[model samples]
Target: MAQTPLPDHPMRYALANELHARPFPVLKAPCRAMYLAIKKVENAAERDRSEDLAHLEALLDRYGASRPAPNADQYSGKLGRGFLKWEMHTEFVTYTLFATEPHSEPFSPDLFNLFPRDWLADAPGRIVTSCVVNVETVEPEDREDYMNRNFPGWFVPESLTASAVTEDTAVVVGDFQIDEHGHMRFAVLAHPDITDSRLGRIVQRVLEVETYKSMAMLTLPTARKVSGTVAHLDRELAENAAGMARESNEAAEVLRRLLTMTAEIEALSSATAFRFGAFEAYEAIVMHRISALRERRIGDHQLLSEFMMRRFDPAMRTCRSSKGRLAELSGRAERAANLLRTRVDVANQEQNVEILKAMDRRAALQLRLQETVEGLSVVAISYYAVNLAAGLLAPIGYKLGLDKTHVVALLTVPVVIAVWLGVRRLKHTLTDGEDGHG
Candidate 1:
């Protein structure tokens, strides 16, 4: 019987397949691998990823090997007598070439010649790191003799990190130093009993650890370059904060300086944010890869984790401290700005209050002057009115047998009173008009 078809999302199969897309290469013993990682120095994450794919295709074409799918992120195929595996990451790409043929010399520089010089010169990005890994099968009984015979001249003694990994199935050794050929080297002595898949996983982990370590260390230069500037900013922030506390310092000037400091700190944060973040992620990957090795000590030699703790951890700490200082300074600047702004606002409010008081005093003086002028106007009007009345009443006084001086005296009091009443009424009318308008 035919089963009914079920509904499915478009990306269901693609998403499920993505988990197993980049399976570990099955590597046998007595193999030598050359690993190379390439990345653009600037704007790596935003570069034209298609160019990477095109470059990979070009390499595949040179070998007459089958090309990867158009959208594939990883590909593996045969190259001459060896196998080639290519992977694209967010900010870089990696190529790993495995040669199964046994070599006469361990850590030989000639193994890197498989990659043509012209091809490397034509790469779209600069080399981030390159390493050569030698894999050998050594019986447990012969492991000590093997290490004593080959490890001394090949790797430095003080920085050597040797460990038995995967429950003693293999021993891994590295000095974390670049050789005269400008390539890092690692050796994996696998027990005869280990499976090919397990050996491949071990080799992959070793490469990942080294690659991520180099990537993480890239942030060190950035941190060192910015350290002096950051220190200067820190001192400036402290000075501004001190100025804010002093009453004699101008709040506006201090505020302007604080704003400038804030802008500079913000710019620093923006500039370093991506690098610091990438460093942390790469650092975590390096540690996780090392931890996954499940390393057990080989004699008195340091383990990989111990080597990292001593050599690499300090740089990591520096980057963390720089990021933290930036954050602390940003916070301090913000607080200082807020406090200065409040001080400026209060000062302005006090000034405004003084201005209002001055206006009130001027308004009071003007009212007194207006009152004095109105009184003088009333007196002048009364004097004129009394004279005019006496002059007109002189005829009546003569007809009634009265003297001009008596008429003048009678007109003076009545005329002055009338004029005063009229002036008072006019003032009342004008005051009422002003009140109504208001």
Candidate 2:
């Protein structure tokens, strides 16, 4: 009998498979590489992903290469003498092309011919970054001559940073400068005996360092733009907050302006939140990649990590400063708003108190007026009642042998007292009933 099998979760297989989705490319030394990153001008993450896939398929079709699966964000295919790798990220897509054969000259424009001219022009998004990376196998003895001749013409010596990385397994050099074609360049010289896979890993890390560094710097302009706006908002908030101390200040108007400022600040934060986060993450990746290099000094020149610290550190600090300022301003505005609301509430309460006092005075006047009216009503009713009694008793008095005027005179005092007592008793009864209900 077969053994009983255990059940698996619905997402178990997919989650496990996702871990191995993107693997490092296999590469050999003596190669030429081109890398391109594309991102839309607006809302790159929300752009039509289908367009990216179509662009890749079109390029693949040109070389009779295999197409990627449906909704695939990554693809690797063999070209004539080169291979192409495509990977999609949240805000951008990257294309890396590699060839085993080396280009004789350094930083040649012809190396990019691997990509179809028409296809590159018709790419779905604009090229956010692209670079020419050349990998060569240079022996330990010839390293000096290699740098002296080609390095000087292409890269500035003052700015060039070179290092021996991977436990001295390879030496990499890049000036981080844009060339005439508007593309950065990197050159790596691995030991001839190094394994192809190891070299591939090294090359990948170098490219990632460059790419992430560029991506991280994109936030600098945004930070600058936000800085100016934040400053203006800060000044306005300060003025309004100061106004709160004045007795004559318009509390409600100040609160309204604070609310409007709060809205603007919140909107700005929301709009730039993603960009700030992406910048930070990319900066971390760049630093991580540099550390992974495990670089040692090849000469007196600065290493990649040092160069980045010297140049990229300031831009990162600027971003951090702007982010911190925004936070502080938001907190200040919130406190000011709460204070203004409290003031408005207190003023309203005072006004309500005055209104209640006025109402009480009016109620006292109404009660006094009602008492005077009740007194008049009793006298008027007594007069009419006495006259009516006189008319009715006049005949009776004549029969009893008494005078009609005398009969009314005796009843007048009794009738008035009785009417006053009856009205008082009725008022008491109605007031007692209302009190019970209440």
Candidate 3:
């Protein structure tokens, strides 16, 4: 028997891996709490399965009619993201219930009968049967109790930590290291379950988790391009006070209109160059910032302030060679745009030449059509003249004891051959320019 390949738990993404550094998984709800197994999007069969989502109303109608024994009343969820997207703002009612007994037997945990552990035992997973929700959620006053419990992954028995406490919420953050054979796995846990309301705590926790994951997925290349453009603009203003970028804001109300006008290049004929140049500028900014940050020449909070200052400043604080290079580049860009236009015009002229040749061919054909028409007319006229002469001669033939029909036919043959040869001679003389008139 052939062996099956093992599945990768955390899936890899192609675009993210190339552009960013890692795969991005949405950590918000309905994406967060899913009933089905999370599979790689590249898998065709799994994608098809997600597409087959049933409406909740239809499922509710099928109890004795459409739904089976459990019915809509028994289930605690609405229709959600299957293999595809769940309609946004819609949610399935899902929770963990604590029960004294196991939920393996026929039971209703919703009736306040089962324990939280029972719900955990019945947790839904793709392949794993007992996949449980990470119950890191807790309340402010009860934070101490949760801390002591020392949950499996997020919290540990203790190292040095700083905690913020409030009447509504408490954020207890700490570092933990777990033994994985000889290697130790590290995790940063922020136990933010403490809140006046359990639901409020849950919302905050989920949102925080989502925000963290999103920030991690953000592509550095994209950020760099954005930063570089701002830096380049700032550098330009520094070089010349009268430059477009350095123009002082005397007309506050008309600033937006001016910006629109700036972008209005009667033609962005080479849009690719413009876009790529802008992106490259942003990339340069990112790199410059990274270098500054690394050297400790700038503070963490100073980046935004500096960027904004550069944007608002009428004149730059320092002038550099980059400004001169940018001026030269702008001139070069205009030249490139003009060259592209010229190339297009040259191509159009070449196309026009081809069209002229085609028209000349069409004119030759029309002239040939006229010649053909004249030849047919001559042949018809000559044939009738011959026949008339033959008919007049046939009377004599009949008188001489010869067939009149045979005499006329034989006379017509010579006339047709002579007409054909004469027409060919005429065509040659005219076309080859051998006529006396030519």
Among these predictions, the greatest lDDT belongs to: 1
Which residues of candidate 1, in runs, are more than 4 Å off?
A: 1-14, 380-438
lDDT per residue for candidate 3 within 1-438, as digits (tens), equals 125586543543534444542112222211122221221222222243222232323433432233322222122322221111111111111221122222331222122222133333332222111112122334446655654555334433343232332323333232223222211111112235332243233332332222222222222333344346535644543333233234333333233333332243222223223333333343344434323222211112122223324431212211122333334445544444344445446666877999999999999999999888877966896678678878788888888787877777777778877777877788787878865656
User: How many backbone clashes does every candidate have?
Assistant: 0, 0, 23
lDDT of 1 by residue, 17-81 (tens): 98998898898898999999999999898999999998888878887889999978999999877
The order of the candidates by lDDT, greatest first, is: 1, 2, 3
User: Candidate 2 residues 1-438, lDDT tens each?
Assistant: 124486677887778878877777778888878899988878887899999999999988888889999999788888768788899888888999888775677777675787888999999889878888888889988888887878888787878999999988889999998899888889998898989888888988998898888889989999999899999999999899889988864889989999999999999998988888889999999999999989999768899999999999899999988888888888889999998999999999999999999999999999999999999989999999999999999999989887888888978999999999999999999999999999
The global C-alpha lDDT for each of the candidates, from Candidate 1 onward, is 0.90, 0.88, 0.36
Quote the lDDT for 55 in model 1: 88
Candidate 2 overall lDDT versus native: 0.88
**Candidate 3 total steric clashes:** 23
